[model samples]
Target: MSDTFSPRTLGILGGGQLAQMLALAAIPLGVRVVALEPDPQAGARLCAEHLCVPYTDPAGLARLAKCDAVTLEFENVPLEALDFLEGRVPVRPGRGLLAHSKHRAREKEGLRAAGAGTADFAVIEAESDLAGALAQLGGQGILKTSELGYDGKGQRRVQSDAELRAAWDDLGRVPCVLEGLVPFTREVSLGVARTASGNLAFGPLVENVHRDGILRTSVYTGGDQRAEAQAREIARAVAEAWGLEGLMTLEFFELPGGELLVNEVAPRVHNSGHLTQDGGGVSQFAAQVRAVLGLPLQGWKPPLPTAMVNVVGVDGLDGQALEPDWGAIDALPGTQIHLYHKAHRQGRKLGHVNLTAPDAETLRSRLAELERLIP
Candidate 1:
């Protein structure tokens, strides 16, 4: 919490590309990162010191508690694990934020309570609640599990009572939320970082394109002053309302009338913000590290139009077949490629490329060329 701080240790609770990137960002600041993850092959292990243990392992938690502060890469980390580390060491954007964001019902409630616009939704605890909830949502809705849903997993679109029943049964009859679908023009996300002292920094509003519910590309499209202001306002409000002390991302559905409806919240660095690494003055990972350490936030918009494309593993391909043509991608101008050291699996994120150009047309041309070369 001091301005005159020196190199220190930081703890991360998950080990994915997000954690890996966070670790990489912290390196230049002289901060050492220790990541606790059960997977030995976790990409984060490439940069940070690895604990290599279950998150529930007491010894692992104890090791994490010894660090200067703790944070998480993914929102799905157990609340109990966070609770255990709460007072022992600083846990920025703590358990309360995690709990609120992890459950679909609670996240929507929090958004409503904050006076933020969100789609109409109802909680469904049983099959009987499905029809009524769908009816409340105007007969078409997305049935999503209350927890552990991501990238289109644990969700089903239902327009009929029969489909609703099947969706409920398919999801193991768990508690769910039936949300009305928004007639959105495009999906944009705002990434904001805040410190315990309330200092804030925002990344550019990114327009995202998704394939099979997985984010395919995030393009920096911030020339619209009105829309940009609204997006930043929504992000700041959510951060303050949640008393957040680290990075948080708000995914919004921009309506045809220019109204923004909060769609989801990720209580940590988000995939949509991946372009920040090359596009923004301060990357989300760097801002997160600064915030958790109680340092002042610093950032500015990118000088050029930038686009990020996710390299996802193709379905029905083994690890060898899933290998991308990295050589070809690296040949493009003003392009930065990041490959996460992860084993190839169906639909898994393998890497991403950040492309920057003097103008949107040039960026689009480069992206099209890259797409053709990707295997």
Candidate 2:
């Protein structure tokens, strides 16, 4: 691996909060970022040189190609665009992982190929296939679009043949994957960073809670010896199998019998990892930047127990009508807040707060206090 210590330019394909955080992490390392996004008001534009153009725009791709190393903030970036930039500039984690992650079917296949266990699933090509797919998965399953789905979107739960047909129709008869629901006790996610030189760093295994299929909170699980070992092994195997050059997150289901099944893979920095920013010495964004630049990777150890609470836009409350008491939140000890400056809508991720405590009891107390503060 080559050293990139001399003022390097990093290119990011999407300009959302992830890219914004990455840009902030790169500043102290003397690394500059060029973000390609259609929105001129993207959060990343606050820190990086923004190329205000669509992902597929020729001029935008050309400008991104000039960076020393490029990475994507979101998986939905056009594969063709990454293909165009592959040889022109080094795109970390590469397009192979991107292609696998961009679609649900391909992602499941990639996991099975790596010898990882996943929920039994089948493909739904058309409405006609829904009934048979449902039968194959035992009459109850989730029908998800094969591509471009996130945060509970592009998914439908069907318990009967009639419901299956309706869901297929509702999803526009697009290519989809039908996965049997697993009766799991809880959800956990692990983030791993691997460099080109094969150095690896693992973030704390976090227990996740979701509401309406969107991540609501992630608590750092520090002392679960068995679960932590298994989770780390799964993450490491997947990263090594894909030969990942940057960061990726593996979300898993913890069954009642103490088995971990792979749920999904995000081939970039993940939302569940937001706690790393304040809980530990190295944040996920910083680790990603170092990995992409071929810098040495370092392990993360949380200095205190922490929990991250996601602040979602309230239903029936317009962005203009919602006003949070920031002063009250800031007054709380060991709390750090980060608000993504974006137009708010119902169920949208507006920001997150990281609360740290000396132990688990105080952490739970802080979480309860935070719940009362959110509007």
Candidate 3:
């Protein structure tokens, strides 16, 4: 590992709030970021030092010429483009991890290869494969995912064998995975970071609540001795397996019998850990910056009790934006607000609030206050 963490220039593949937050974290390290996105009005566009021409453009390849290390804000980046820049600039997490993250089938295979536990599933390459998958599951199941799917998109729940064909067509008969739904008691996530030198660190398991299949709140469960230990081991194996560098998140399901099963993996800073900004002494964004830059590990502390509420913007929010209301939420001590500047769009993630207290009850109360304040 290099003694110094400084990089002349850092290039980011997507220009969303994640990139914006990453740029915010890199500021103290004196590193400038170059962002690549098609939208000039993207959230991170204003924050990055230099915005590259466009992803997959020849000019974008030219922009990579100026960067020392590159990272992705999202998993949808064209792999061919990253392949062109790999030898020239350091791409944290590397191409293999990125490739695995893009597809659900491959992700499960990677997890199995790493000796990690995951939900029972089968690969679906064509419509015929769907029937074979259903036969294997032997009962009601779900068509796992299409490569680029997010936020409940590109998935269908099949109740009977009859629905399998329709579900397959609904997903455009694309390559996917079919997973046996688990009757899990709760869903949680453990965010982890790995440096180039194999140093690993993990945040505690967070209890996640989802609405419409998108994460709504992530509350700290705090010190589940067994789950925490298993989570750390799982995260470490993932990092070691991919020989991954930088940050990634592992979402897990706590089964009825007290066993933990892997849910999904995000090879980047995740929405579930947004609370780290105020709860943990080290925010996930800050940790990611440090890891990607090869900085030394630091202290890890949890905000004994904390709750993170995601703020989703609905249309016609501009009227409410002018008189932004945080009075009730702000009244709570140790509360922090993070707003992403994005144009009004239905169900778009606007920002989040991290409220902390001595216990989950107090944290819930503060979150209730925040809900009332959201205009």
TM-scores, one per candidate: 0.95, 0.95, 0.92
* 1 against 3, candidate with superior TM-score: 1
lDDT of 3 by residue, 231-298 (tens): 88888888899788888899998998878888888988999888877775777887887787777765
Which regions of candidate 3 fall more than 4 Å away from where they truly are?
Answer: 1-7, 299-301, 315-325, 372-375
Per-residue accuracy of model 2 over 155-211 as CA lDDT, tens digit each? 999999889888888999899999999999999988899988899998888889998
Please report how far candidate 1 places residue 110 from its true position, in Å: 0.3
Local lDDT at 48 for model 2: 96
Worst 10 residues of 2 by lDDT: 315-324
Task: Tell me the TM-score of model 1.
Answer: 0.95
Taken over the whole model, the C-alpha lDDT of each candidate is 0.87, 0.87, 0.79
- For candidate 3, the 10 contiguous residues with the lowest summed lDDT are 315-324
lDDT of 1 by residue, 1-375 (tens): 354468788999998899999999999888999999999999999999999999988899999999989999988887668868988999987987887898899999998888899999989886567656777889998989999999989999999888988889999999899889899999998888888888988888889989999999888855767888998998888889998988899999999999999999998888888887887467888888988987778864576788899989885434455555678878889789888998777788998989887888888888888777664
Error of 1 at 365 (Å): 2.1
lDDT agreement of model 1 with the native: 0.87
